[model samples]
Structure formats: structure tokens, C-alpha cells
Target: MFILLFSAVLAESLVEIVNSDPTSSWVAIDYPREVITLAKMRAMLGDETEVDGLETMEYVEPDGVPTSFDARQQWPGKLFAVRNQQSCGSCWAHATSEAVGDRFAIKGCSKGVLSVQDLVSCDKNDNGCNGGSGPRAMSYAQSRGITTETCLPYVSGNGRVPSCPSKCKNNSTITRYKTQNNPTFTVANVQQELMNNGPLYFRFTVYSDFMNYKSGVYQHKSGKQEGGHAVLLVGWGVENGVKYWLCQNSWGPSWGERGFFKILRGNNHCDSEKGFWAGSVKC
Candidate 1:
């Protein structure tokens, strides 16, 4: 008993092996051992608006079953995807594009992948490839609208912020998307909104252990605090008694649960559920 207790304590002090995925889609990287740079780990969401301090609507958990509802499953090809931002911290732009892109699909608008490259290059309020807030990206979409991937492909992978383009290459064919800002809310309010609104732009803190998360409902276990990250929250579900929010990431399909993750829900675990901007995609 004493030896077992000591071993448990020792394990807590170290990054545990988390790659016990049943489906085997997780690609694990023992983060601390791998040692990713501070710059590379710094994805956007650091500039998110304070939703917890806002005038929030009261949320009452309605009657429901503990089950899964996948946005990808619902919309099929229409739903936005889990992409890669390379080593750039343009997650804010990526999340914003996917979130509103989903809204376009939900409203029966033509299916399109909104361009993060446009936001990265054009949103004068943001830091381009360095970092930016998801909310600001939404507002940028609302004001001037954003072009598609074909019009302006992502060049942030080259690791330099270019000047904002005065004109999209395929200006006439470029389908732009627009959005209106909505207040941020908790997981209590997410269930219905996700069903009705498609996907949402959300942010959360990333810990060292997150790098090892391949599968399973993620919770902050043992690891160093990394920094803030922005992602798209598409839906919610329950798995093995744990309520989780299904999130789509921009780290490509090779990361997380096939570029998606089920995070522990309801208590705002890692601040992912704390505050997320809701919006209306102008169809």
C-alpha cells in the first residue's frame, strides 16, 4: 500500500502516458520531452473578449440524454474542417472562419470554407500570423466580409506577416461571409446553440499534457501550463459518464482525436466552456 501510494504520487509529478485510445486515432507527443517552442505553442485566443464578465443570459440545463452529436456527421461535406495552421498562431483566424462557415451551411447557404488567410492578412485590428482574437475576426467578417481559400490561400506557414491585400485574386468569384456579434455563454447554453447555430469560435488554455492528448475526454491532469489557444466548438456529448464538448482543432487531422477532441464539460474545464462568442452568419 505504501509503495503504491508513493508510485501514484510520483506519477502525478510527471507527465503520464495518455495514449490509451480505444479507436487508436490519437498521435501522441510527450510534450515536455519534445519541447515545442513558446512561439509555436502560442496560438491565438489570448485576445478573446471577457465573456465571464459580460451580462450573460441565465442557462438552465434542460432534459436530455447523455449522447453524442457530431457536427461533421450532421452536415457531412458542408461542415468546416480540422485544418493545420502550420507553426503560426493564427488559430483565431481559423476558428473564426470555420465557425461562420458552419453557420452558412446551417442556414442552407452554399457550402464554402472561409479563408483564414484573408483574416490573417487583412484584419488590421489583429496580429496576422503572430496572434489575434477570435471575436475580432468575427467583427472583421461582419464589417468588410472575408473571401474564400481559392481567392487568398494561407501564406502564414512561410512565417511572416504580409501586407493586407488590397484585392482578392478572384474578386468576382470570391464568396464572402459576414457575421454579427453575440454574447458568450457557458456549456449550459451550448447544447441548443450548437444544434441551431452550427459551430462556435471558442478559446481555452493549453497545458503541457494537452500535447499528449490523443483520445478520451480531456481534462487538465498533470502538466505545465502552456498558454491560450483558440478552437471551434461544434457540438456536445457524453462518453463514459463524462459530459464533453466536441471541439474541432486547427492542428490538422493528425492531432487530437482525428483533429477533434471531446473535452470535459459543464465546469468550464480549461476555460473552454467559460465564454465563447455566439453569432449570426448573414445568409
Candidate 2:
């Protein structure tokens, strides 16, 4: 015996939850509805132009075994997990800041875990924490430079600050080689980069159903399309002849079997046949 119920929220996101047992539960969402709702709100407030630059990158999978060449065998013992501004659309800052934090860890210094708050409040290129491109944010970091998390910490609540942090002590040990603004990167390239570098940043359209992703291989939910903002490429491997890329999510350890997801490696999803890769500087 199974039962399902559907309800809509104030945010216009339709939620469907299923009760399997006395205690077990599940949920499903109507992503398009949420997008439409957001769109309508923007239209009503004359904020349509604010979402103008947001673009959906084409999805491409990688080809072969991805490799990492960086000297750092694994991410810093103290990796900083970040929460992407989903409906708020600040993935660009989250992705860039997370990568920077990881790069700092590779420096073998104090394991600097920089704050995303700094990027969110300080960066001028993109709309604060709203959706922005990784390359663009990286370019901004290169030009103006980023401050340590110590000087400026992150604040989770909403509301904007009139002024930005003034601390300018540069303690990062990572260097950006070249950044590509392609819609997606190949898995082969990702894997190779992981073997060569340390970790990589990625963005994908997450379906609301993903919030309920428990375990096992994930397939797109039927009639569902909730695009997520940002994620991290941690590791990759072949499981029982099937290839998979281990993704580290920021939904906290309570979700998805310790906040981790395994995606079909090298599939058209976000262009990584080999695997998307990002490098870190060796200190």
C-alpha cells in the first residue's frame, strides 16, 4: 500500500511527499513551477533584467579515465563545504570560494578555509551571491585579489551590507592556469585534472527530487527539473563495471548518504567523460 500527497508552497515550488511507512517519508517537486513563480515575482517587481545574464550551459559527458596530476593526493584534511544560494542564485560565488578554500588547504599552511561570505559581500562582478560564472569570479579574484577568511567571516542571514571588508592580506597558495567558460567540461578532462590537480567546481540544474536523493545510481526524475547551483568534484571510479564520479554536495552530512552523490561519469551531464578538473598550487 502506497500513498502520495502534493502541496504548493508560498515560494511557488510544488512539493509532493510520499509516506512509505509509519516513519519513513519522501518528497518530490515541480521544478518548472518554481521557476515560473520566481519569474513572475521578478516581473511584478520589474527585476526581470536581474536574471538576464543567467545562461544554461550545454551538457556533455567525458570520454576516458580522468586523471589528476597535482602533488596533493587528496583535498585538505579540512575541506570547507559551502551552501550554494539556490533560489537566491549565488552559485558563482559559492563555487569560486569553495575552490579557493581547497586551494588554500593544499598550500600545507594553516589549512586556510576562506569564507564564502567575503566573496558574497565583496565581489562586484556578479550579483553578490546570485548566479555568476566561475571563470568570471576567478578573473575578479585575480584582478582585485581575495582576503583571508580571518579578516572577513561569512554571514548566513539575508540583508546587504553597505560597505565591503577592507582587509587585504593575501595568503592563498593556489594559482589559476586558464579558465574556460564552456557550458560544460568533459569527464575525461575532469578526471585527468583531478589526477593532476586536487578538486574541481561544477554547476548543474538540480531537480527538486534531488533533495530526496537517498542512495544508489541517480536518474533524472520524471517530469522534474530542479536545477541546482554548484557542486564539487571529489573523486571518480568504476563500480561493478559502471563508471561513476563521486560528487561532494553541500547539503550537509545528513543528506544523500553523508552528503555525497555518484553520477554517471563521462555522461553528457555537465561535460565530463574523463572528469572535470581544477588545479591547486603546491606550497
Candidate 3:
């Protein structure tokens, strides 16, 4: 009990110090005070995967790439609603589903939400709620495909992944939405991928200070290493001379800027530029 209280108090003090910095590009909040232990916070973020020499999609820089771009604004209602993984380390599943769903929408396919639960329970290549890789999830989506949220639905919030179901909740036949190829995009062509495809899945190292992020361009300032997390990379922009990537997190709409946050771009802060995965949908 004493340890938990001490940790919470220490984190709160750190937030105060971060907010007090007048030159800080971001603001911190004490919203994640409920997560008393590092293990609990880590449970919300999946482990990061190594992507050295991993094959990335072939690319050529498209003309007229703008300095500022947002996938949510570019495709309006095509992006799925920001979701919450709760205490489950299923960020890999959530990010992959959002990216695939966004691509499906952009490709003039079904605009309905895809099932993260399908990936969580059925993707044998992944460990479900414990932790998974974004690239592995993408590969699973390409090979086996994923069903709609209406077919399987998500129930892993309590850190328990239910058994994979063979049929939809309503007993209707399952429709597996798939992507043509498991294409990995690099930081050099991330903007072009977003402009041509949609939101993409990427993992990053999460720090304790990042849990308190409220708004603005986030750059890790303090706190110990927590774990790795995956999020949907939506777009990019320059805020106050700092280039940042706009991302949508799965911690729900209450956290950050309506479930979206901007992080330092170009320099690969938090390893956010690594593990990029996006592909063309197969409807």
C-alpha cells in the first residue's frame, strides 16, 4: 500500500513539474493515477518489435506533399471511432484493426469497424492480451483476414481474451476483411503512404511521463521506461517549429486530444517511427 501511494504521489509531482515548464510544447495531466503499478501501465502497452532490415514497401515521393496533413480531416468519417483497450495489452490488435479498417474505408469498401477481438482471439501468431506485434498482426490480417466488430466484438478489456469464435455473435456468417499485401512503410515514405493509403500501425517505447500527456507536440521529458505501445499514425504537422506526427491512441476519447496526440517527428522520438505497417485492402 505504501509503495503504491508513494509511486502515485511521485508521478503526480512529475506531472506538476512538466506542466510548470513554460517552454514545454505539451501539457501533462494526472488522469492515469488509477494505474498504480508499472506492470498495470505496461499491461496497457504491448511490447515493441525489432524491425532491422525488415522489408518495407517500395516507394517514390509523391508530388505536392504538404507540410501539414491529418487523415481524420482528409477522409472525414472514414476513420473508425477511437477505442479503449482498457487494462489489456492488446494495443497491437487495436492499432492493426484501426489501420486496416481505415484502409478499407478509403478503398471504397465497407466503412464498418473491423474486429480487434478477431485478431486478439484468433491470430495464433500473436499472444492476444499479453502482447503482440503490429507487423505480425498485419500479416495475420493479410493471410487469414479479420471479421467485422459485429461478428466477433471485443471483450478483452479485463485482460482476458475469450476463446476464438467460429460464428458471428448473431450467428450470421462471418465476413473476413483482408489486405492484399502486408506492406511495411518506412519513415522516409510515411507521409506518402498515409496520403495514398490511410492510417498505419506503428509501435513505440512508452515512458511513464507519456501517460499524462494532454495536448500539444509531445516529447519525452521525464519518468522511467514503462513499456512499448502501438498506435495509429494519422498524419503530420509542424507545431511551433517542432515537427510532430499526429497519432490516434486506443486509450479512448477521454485521454489526450479526443484520443489523438502529436509526438516529435523526424528524430524518431520514443522509437515511434519504427514498426510501420499498412496495406491496400481487399474488401
Candidate 4:
């Protein structure tokens, strides 16, 4: 019993386990920490039930979808930079906004960064900071539209989502942009959509070990289940004989690899390879 207790404690020390494990596909390092409880982690993912209704758009598989693909490489100078969601469990908002923003940029729209705060505050369908799903946020983005990040900058990192504003913070004649033609791509054709469009939005079960991800491809070597968290699916490739999905997180650039991570791919680790949603910007 004593040995089991000690082993559990050791496993909880992310830095220790990650650094010592020879077989760990990923790496970990210590950083200034936040006391993220299980409840908060659960809130990070929000309600994803709305995603069940997504209609899978048919796509004729194109010849030669690359074995490896990265949106950043494909569309240089267009994709928005990584952003921080702060203390708010607004990954849902960030992922949807960022994915839409990327589509906008890929389509040669004038703006790149969209207002995550716009969805966090104004989208009545979602639960603000407490939690929301990618599809619901996409739905909100489609119907009502969202403004640029410059117009209504994100200030809800402190966990308090401000009231929906009637006008932009900069008051520069807000031009709202909407996403059109919601398309759902399954594992069979996900890469094709990403190659044709921009980033895709999806949610996956995040484990406690995920918080300690520093670099390399991650595969849940240890730790307990945290909760579902939404993120932007950016790319995928194989590293050291292991396949991984390169995803961007909203926790900011300080976390993971410049606010991005790679998880076990193809096998649907944490359901990462499930159907994902993306759309073109109605600029």
C-alpha cells in the first residue's frame, strides 16, 4: 500500500515522470503553476452535445493528400498567431474564433484575428466562460457574426466575461464577418479539408498529463482524466515512428510548443481524429 501511494505521488510530479520515462513520446518541464482543479478542467471543454448533429459533408478524396501537412507551412503570413485564453475556460470560443480567423485569412480576407470575446460575451447559445462547444460557437459565428480582435480585444482571461457590447471598444465602425458552409470532415478526409481550407476545430479529452506537455509527440503516458477541451487542429505528421496530430491550444504560447501540441494520431487518441468542423469566411 505504501509503495502504491508513493508511486501515485511520483506520477503526479509531471516533471519527474516525463523526464525520467525513457519510453515517453513527449517531454515535460516545470513552470509557474496554476491550481487547476478537475472541475475547472471539466469546464474548459463545455457542452459538446451540439456537435452530434453536425452533417457530414461529402468530399471526393483528392489524390495525393500529403503524408504530413501543416497549415502554418501551407499558408504562411495568413494564419493568426497563437493566443492566450487566460483563466477563462474559453477554449471553445478561442478555437472557433481562431479557426474561423484562419479560414478568413486563407481566403484572402482583410482581417485575420477574430474576437473571441465576441462569442464569450454575446453568443447567447453558449455558456460564456463556464464552457461551450465548437459547433455551438460555430453556429453563433455563422448566424450573428463576429468582429475583429482589434475592435473588441479579449479581456476575459480573468474568468469574467464582460457584457455583450453594442459597439466595438475602438469604435472604428465594426465590420462583422461570418463563416459560411459548415463542413464536417471525418478521419477519412480530414486532411483534404485542411489542405483545401485552413484549420479545423475539434474537442478531445484532456488528461492531467496533458498539462505538462512541453515538446515532442504526446501519448498520455500517465496522470488522470482532466476533461474535454476544444482546440484548433493545425497539422499532422510522424515523429520517431509515432503518428501525431499537431494541434494549437488556447492556453497561450507559454504552454506546449508555442501554444501548440501533438497527440497520438490516426488511432483516435482522446477522440482527436473524430469529425471536425470548418468553414469559409463570408467576407
The full ranking of all candidates by lDDT, starting with the best, is 3, 4, 1, 2
How high is each candidate's TM-score?
Answer: 0.81, 0.63, 0.92, 0.87
Tell me how far candidate 2 lies from the true structure as C-alpha RMSD in angstroms: 8.5
Ranking by TM-score: 3, 4, 1, 2
130-213 per-residue lDDT for model 2 (tens digits): 445555566655555455555555553243433564543344343222222222334335555655445666655555445545
Question: Lowest-scoring 10 consecutive residues by lDDT in candidate 2?
Answer: 41-50
| Error of model 2, residue 162, in angstroms | 5.5
Cα lDDT listed for each candidate: 0.70, 0.47, 0.83, 0.77
The CA lDDT at 279 in model 2 is: 35
- Alpha-carbon RMSD of each model: 6.4, 8.5, 2.8, 4.3
Alpha carbon lDDT at 212, candidate 4: 69
Q: Per-residue lDDT of 1-283 in model 3, one digit per residue for the tens?
A: 8877887886787788789988789998877554324556678888556655554433333467898999889999899988988889999999999999888888888648999899999998899988889778988988988899988889998999888887899999888977899877787777888898899987788888888888999988888888889899999898998888899999888889999999988766777765588868765
lDDT of 3 at 191: 88
How close to the true structure is residue 54 of candidate 4, measured as C-alpha lDDT? 44
* Number of clashes found in candidate 1: 0
Q: Candidate 1 on 1-283: residue-level lDDT in tens?
A: 6754653444334333444434332334433322332344554334344445544344345556336777788888878667888767788888888888778877888547778888888899888776777667777878877778877888886567777776676555555666766555555666767776788888887876676576768877655676778888877777777777789888777666778887877676776656776578766
> Candidate 4: deviation at residue 107, Å?
1.3
